[model samples]
Structure formats: structure tokens, C-alpha cells
Target: MLELLDLLWTFFKIGLFTFGGGYAMIPLITESVVAKGWLETSQLIDFIAISESTPGPFAINIATFVGFNQAGILGSIFATLGVVLPSFIIIVIVAKAFSKFATNKFVLGFLRGVKPVVVGIIFSVAVSFILQNVFSFSFKELGDFIFKWSTIIIFIVVFAMTRIWKKIHPIFIVLVSGIMGLIIYGLIL
Candidate 1:
């Protein structure tokens, strides 16, 4: 009971404070979940991957998974509700006031300020993930970095494919990358 309430409060706080959707929320989620010992960094990474692969919002998916992992189905319910409640309330408030505020300069300025912050958060998350998963650094040599050749190759291929065939869906890119991962890591060595 206490644990479930804790989950609810924590997720509620996460959802309330997090802006700019899931990618932007990664750092906050990492801090809260890791600090609470709810999930390790590796587990959080896995949760991120699973969340991306699954349907609905990534943050909500993570909340549900973490809740279920902690205290079963009821926990999942509480955590999900907690995470969503803030968004629901805010949307209601925003919807009611949007007409009045639509042309307000202060509100417009505030939103403009927020766009850069959201972009910065998303870029930070991207760089962190790239460093963790795609590159290795060497202590022996200053400014030396080791790259995973296979992963780099996959990245190049995916980038080229996406650029060349603009209509290709992201799922195809995911599938291709998965197959490449299997071949490179699973069967190569």
C-alpha cells in the first residue's frame, strides 16, 4: 500500500514536471527512477528500448512497466494514472484558456523560450545515448575515442537509406538495425 502510493506520487511528480514529451523526459526519468532504486541505468536503457518498440507514449509505457515491475497490475494502474493525470489536468486548463491567451505576447514569449529548452534536453539525451551505446573512449590517449565499427556501419546505412528513400517508414529502419545487430553481434564473432 505504501509502496503503491510512493509510486503514484513519484510518477505524478515526473509527469507534472516533464515537458516536451518522452525524448525530452529521459534525463528526468533516469534521475528519479535510478535514485529511487526502482531501475538501474541498464534497466532504464532496456525500458527505453522497449518503450520505443511498444505503442503509446514512451513515458507512460515506462511508468506502467515500472509500476508492474514493482507491485503488479494494480501498481501499473496507479503509476499510469499518476503519470497521465497532470497532462489531463493541464490540457483541460489550456483548452479552456487557449482562446483568451492565443494572442498574448507573454504567453507567446514563454512558449518561444520553452522551445529552445526542449531542444536542448532532447539533444543532450541523444548525445548521452550515443556515447553510452555507440562509442567508447580511451583513457590512455587524451581526446581519443573508439567507435563501434559495426554500429557505425549500421548508422551510415540507415542514414543513407533514409535519405535516399524519403518515404521509408521508421519501423523499417528499426527492423534493418535489429537484423544488423543480430548479424554483427550474434553471428560475426
Candidate 2:
């Protein structure tokens, strides 16, 4: 009961404050969930991957996943609703007022300024994820320890395959990566 309410309120606040969609919301979610001890950083990373692979908005997907992990189906419903409600209400209000502010210079200027800020926020989230998961900043000697070539090769191959093999579904790429990782791990161990 109280836990459900907490889930709803927390996700609602996240949705309300997060601008520019999922990537932009990552930092805020990390602070709220990971820093606050609601979830671990590894759990957040898994949520991110699952969210990206699922349908609908990435932010909503993530919110629902986290909520479901915490308190099952009902929690997922509440969290999803909380995450989407603000966007729905804001869109409705903006639509109703569009005529009045359609040609306002101030509005235009604000929109222009917002674009770069949103890009910056998304970029920062990407950097954080890379540092946390891919590169741990532990490379003391450049020659002694190089970047993980296997991961780099996988990335390049996947990128190339996606561009060239237009008919292949993204899920296939994910599955292949998983299999490759297992095989590599088995050989290494």
C-alpha cells in the first residue's frame, strides 16, 4: 500500500522533472534510484538495456521495469502511469495554448536554447554509462593494458552488420552478442 504510493510518487516526480526523453532522464533516475539505494548501478544498467529493447518510450519502459521488479504487476501499472501523465498533461496544455504563443519570439528563443541543453544532457548520460560499464579508468599503462578489443570488434561488426543486413532484426544482434560473450567467457575461463 504505502510502497505502491511511494513508487507512483517517485516515478511521477521523475517524469515531471525529466526533459528530452529517456537518455536525458538517465542521470536523474540514477541519482534517485541508485544513489538513494532503491536500486544498484548494475540493476540500472540492466533496466536500461531491457528498456531499450522493449516497445513504447524508453523512460516509461524503464520505470515500469523497475516498478515491476519492486512490487509486481500493479507496481508496473502505477509507475507507467506516473511516468506518462506529466507528458500527456503538458502536451494537452501546450496544444490548447499553441495559437496564442505560435509566433512569440521569446518562445522561439527558449526552444532554440533548449535543444543544445537536451543534447548535452543525453551526451552526459552516454558518457556515464561508458565509464561505468565499458571503461573503468583503470588502465595505468597504455601498452600493458589496451582497450577491450573484443568489445570494440563486436561493436564495429554489429554496426556494419546492421547497415548492410537491412533485413536482420535487432533482437538477432542482441542474441548474437550474448552468445559471443558466453563463448568468449568459456574460452577465457
Candidate 3:
């Protein structure tokens, strides 16, 4: 149907244009999906959190979540295909050519140039998420910014735990954070 193709094309463009990774692709994804009225910013945030926390590749999970939420199981298939196809094709082409051009100055320069852009995008996404969660900043408004005290408390505790315990694993931190969220937001506020 028209909707399925739209889903496929939207994510196809996203996957093709997305240079970095899931984090780097966040801004583009937000613009595309939110502009299309496919998902609200808050709902997209939830999908983002779910995608990050769950197992499997981040981009695929997010694409699938958006597709499923927008349509259904079939939509997930189309969207996932759209997102993966570009990379699959590009990697195949690059793998074939990269060896021959591995030492070429142009290729090397292009790769070098992309690294900083990717880092910047990821860094911006991190700061944006922190602002949204910790400072309650939203895309919809400029004023009425309020501090999220409970989230800030959780953030500080988790940050301190990470710094204090160098041996701690990331998965454990995520689990603890999730539990803390449940306790603070779900129960005691």
C-alpha cells in the first residue's frame, strides 16, 4: 500500500543519509518522523530509551519501533528493510573498492573529514538528551523550563557510581538506572 511504501522510503532515506550511527542519526530521524507527524517528541524519546535499553542493533530497533508504532508488524519489516538495505549495498561496494584505494589520499581525507562530524552529532545528541531529561527542555517551548530533580538525582548517582567504580560494567549501570527510574518515577516520585 501507499503507507508501506512511504515507510520504506522514509527509512530508506534515513538509512542512506545517516553517516554515523543511531545517536548521530537522531536529529535526522527526529526531523523526518516528527515532521511527518509519525511520532510525537515525547513518544520518540520513549522509543529511543527502549531502543537503547533493549538488545540488538540500536538503529534497527529504533526503525522497527517507529514502523511498528506507526503501522504494525508488517510496517516493521518494511522499515527495517529500508534502513538496512543502503548499508548493505554501500558496504558491499566499499569493501570491493576500499582495498584498492586504501592508501589513496582522497579516500583517506574523506574518512578523516567524516570522523569529526560524526563525533559532533553524537555529542550534540547526548547534550540534547541530557537537557531534555535533566532540565525539562522541550522542542515545543522556550520557557517554563523546570528542573527534573528526581532524574537529576539519578543522573548524579549513576555518574558518581561510574567514576567511583572503574570495574563496574555498563549493563549493570543500565539495570540499576532502570530500577531507580521505576522506584522514583513509578512509586515514590
Candidate 4:
């Protein structure tokens, strides 16, 4: 009971404070979940992958996945609601007030200031994700080995394919990547 409440409150706080949506929320979610020891760092990375691949918003998907892992269906429901509630309420209020403040210079300045902060947060999140999943600095020799040309090539190819062939749904890419990884791993080891 208390655990559920804590989960709700944590997600609520995250949702309320994070702006610029899912990408911006990643750092906070990683910090809150990983630093607090609520979930393992590896699990959080898995959540990010799953969240990105699935339908719906990234943050919501993460909240649902974590909540379900921690508790059950009810936890998933509560966590999702907690995460979305702040955005919903804020949007409603902002929609009502936006017209009135449409020409306000101070408001415009505040928003402009926020954009860089949000970008910084998202960039930090991206760095963290890349470091954890793609790079390994713990063991010097192994870390050097991990940066293989094949893996780098795969990343470049996938990135280029996504940019150029925008019509390909992301799931297909994920599936193909998974198969490629499996085949490569099998051949290497």
C-alpha cells in the first residue's frame, strides 16, 4: 500500500517537473529510478528500449513497465495516471491562459530559456544511454574491444536507413537489428 503510494508520488513529481515531453523526462527518470535503487540500471536501459519500440509516449510506457514490474496491473494504472495527470492539468490551464499571454515578452523569454534547458536534459539522457549500452569504461581492455567496427557500422547503417527510408516502421528495424545481433554474436562466440 505504502509502496504504491510512493510510486505514484515519485512519478507524479517527475511528470510535473519535466517539460518538453518524453525525451526530456529520460534523465529524471533514470536518476530517480537508478539512484534511488528502485530499479537496476540495466533494467532502466531495457525499459528505454522497450518504451521506444512500443506504442504510446516514452515516459508513459516506462512508467507502465516499471510499475508492472514492481507491483501489478493496479500499480501500472496508478503510475501511468500519476505521470500523465500533471501534463493533462498543465495543458488545460495553459490552453486557457495561452491566448491572453500570446504577446507577452516575459512569457516568450521564459519559454526561450526553457528550450535550452530541456535540450540539455535530453542530451544528458542520450549520453547516459549511449555510455551504458554502447560503451564500457569499467574494464580497460574489454572496453576497447567493445568498440568494434562492425557494431559502429551497424549503428551508422541503421541511422542512415532510418533517416533516408522514413517509410520503414521502427519495429521492423528493431526486429532486423535483433536478428543481426544474434547472428553476429553466434558467429563471434
Candidate 5:
């Protein structure tokens, strides 16, 4: 159907243009999904959280969720296929020529240039997420920043935990955080 085709084309565009994967693709995915009226910003954020917490690649998880929400099982299939197809084809071609370009200065330079861009993209996404979840600004009154203290506290704790316990697995941190959320938001507040 036409709906399936549209889903395929839209996700195809998203997958083809995005680089660095997952977090880096957040802005693009958010914009496209919101513009298409598939999901609201808050819902997208929730979806992102769910996607990150679950298994598989973030981008693929998001595509599957969005597609399933829009149309159902077949929609999920089409959207997933559309998003993955470009990378599949590109990888196949690149693999064939990788040996030839492996020592090429141009390829090396291009990859080096991409590293900083990916970092910037991921940093921007992180900042946006912090702004949305942890800060509220009153721009009319000289841009006063109001903090969501609990979320800020949690962020600090998790950050410190990671830095302090480098050997600890992330799943443990996630589990602890969930328990903290339940205690803080459910029981305390």
C-alpha cells in the first residue's frame, strides 16, 4: 500500500543520510518523525529511552517501533528493510574496494574529518536531552534556568559512579538507576 511505501521512503532517507549511528541520528529521527506527525516530541523521547534500554541497534529499534506504531507488522518490515538496505549495499561495495583504498590518503583523511563531526553530533544530542529533561528556562525574565533537581542529582550520581567504577558493567548501573527512580518518584515523591 501507499502507506508502506511512504514509510519505506522516509526511513530510507533517514538511514541513508545519518552517520555515526544511534545517538548521532537522534536529531534527524526526531525531526522526521515529528514532522510526519508519527509521534510527539515527548513520545519520541520516551521511545528513545525504551530503545536504548532494549537490545539491538538504537536506530533499528526506533525504526521498528515507529513503523509498528504507524502500520503494524508489515510496516515494521518495510521500514526496517528500507533503513538497512542502504548500509548493506554500501558495505558490500566498500568491502570490495577496502583493500584498494585502505592505504589511500584521501580515504584516511576523509575518515579523520568525520570523527570530529560525529563527536559534535553526539554532544549536541546529549545537550538537547539534558535541556529537555533537566532544565527549564524562563527566557522572558532574562533567561533564568530552572533545574529539575532530582533528574540532575541522578545524572550526577550516575556520572560519578561510571567514573569511579570503570570496571562495573552498565547493566548494573541501569538497574540501580531504575530502582532509584522507583524509590524517588514512586515512594518519596
Candidate 6:
């Protein structure tokens, strides 16, 4: 019971304070989960990858993944509800109240300021992921960056495919990447 409540509160704070989408929320989620000893950095990275690839919203998926790992299905429920509730409530309120402030200078100014910060946060997270996953660079220790050939190969192939076949669906790319992973990691190495 206590764990469930903690999960709810932690995720609630994360959801309420996060201005951007899931990519931007990674830092907060990683910090909170790591501080609580609920997950290691690598595990969190894996969860992020899985969440981004899966069907549902990334925030919901991550919350559920963390929650389930902590306290089973009920934890997943509480975490998901906690993360989603704030957005739902805020959207409802904003929908009702926004018309009056739609043109207000203060509101407009606040939103304008937030846009760039969100982009920066997302960009930082993406760079961190690439550095860690592809180059095996550990930001914590400032370790020497080691090139991960398997990952680099996959990245290049997927990137080239996307650039060359602009019309191809994302799922096909994911499928190809998965096969490549299997071949590279499973069979070759």
C-alpha cells in the first residue's frame, strides 16, 4: 500500500511538472527511479526503448513499466492513473478557461518561453541516449567512449533506410532493426 502511494505521488509530480512529451521527461524519470533504487540506469534505458517502441503513449508505458516492476499490476494502475490524471485535469480546466486568456500577453509570453526549453530538453535526452547506447559513453564517470560496432551498424542501416525510403512505414524499420539485432548480437556475437 505504501509503495503504491509513493509510486502515485512520484509519477504525479513528474506528470504535472513535465512541460514536454515523454522524451523530455526522461531525465526526471531516471533521477527519481534511480534515487529510489527502483531501477538502474541501464534498466531505465531499456524501459525507455521498450516504451518508445510499444503501442501506447510513452509516458503511460514508462509509468506502467516502472510501477509494475515495483509492485505488480496494481502499481502499474496507480502509476498510470497518477501520471495521466494531472494532464486530464489540466486539459479540462484549460479548455474551459483558455478562451479568456488566449490572447493575453502573459499567457502567450509564458508559452513562448517554454517552447524552446522543451526542445532543448528533448535534444539533450536524445544525445544522451545516442552517446550511451551507441558509443558506450558513461556521462557519470566521463569514461572513454567506446564504439559499439553492432549498435553503430544498426543505426546506420536504419538511418539510411529511413532516408532512402521516405515512404516506408516505421513498423517496417523497427522490424528490420530487430532482425539486425538478432543477427548481429544473437548469431554473430
Tens-digit lDDT track for model 6 on 22-53? 77788888779778998888888766667656
Better of 2 and 5 by TM-score: 5
lDDT for model 2, on a 0 to 1 scale?
A: 0.75
Pairs that collide in candidate 2 are none
State candidate 2's TM-score: 0.76
Worst 10 residues of 5 by lDDT: 136-145
Tens digits of lDDT, candidate 3, 4-123: 899899999999878766777788888898889988777877776676567888779877988898789999999899999999998888887887678888988997998898898888
Report the C-alpha lDDT of model 5 over 9-61, residue by residue, as the tens digit: 88888888777767777778777878889888778877766775688887788
Q: Which scores higher on lDDT, 2 or 3? A: 3
Scored by TM-score, the top model is 6
User: TM-score of every model?
Assistant: 0.85, 0.76, 0.85, 0.82, 0.85, 0.87
Of candidates 4 and 1, the better by lDDT: 1
lDDT (Cα) of model 3: 0.84
Taking all chains together, the TM-score of candidate 5 against the true structure is: 0.85
Error of 2 at 125 (Å): 1.8
Model 3 residue 151 CA deviation in Å = 2.4
Alpha carbon lDDT at 130, candidate 4: 57
lDDT of 5 at 114: 82
Model 1 lDDT at residue 175: 76
Q: Which ten residues in a row have the lowest lDDT in candidate 1?
A: 136-145
lDDT (tens digit, per residue) of candidate 2 on 1-189: 888888888888899877676777877787776666778877877666666567777877887787888889998988788888888888888887887776789978887898798898888776655554445432223233237866666666776888899888756877776676777666763
Mark the 10 consecutive residues where model 6 has the least summed lDDT: 45-54
Candidate RMSDs in order: 3.1, 4.0, 2.3, 3.1, 2.8, 2.1
lDDT of each: 0.82, 0.75, 0.84, 0.76, 0.80, 0.86
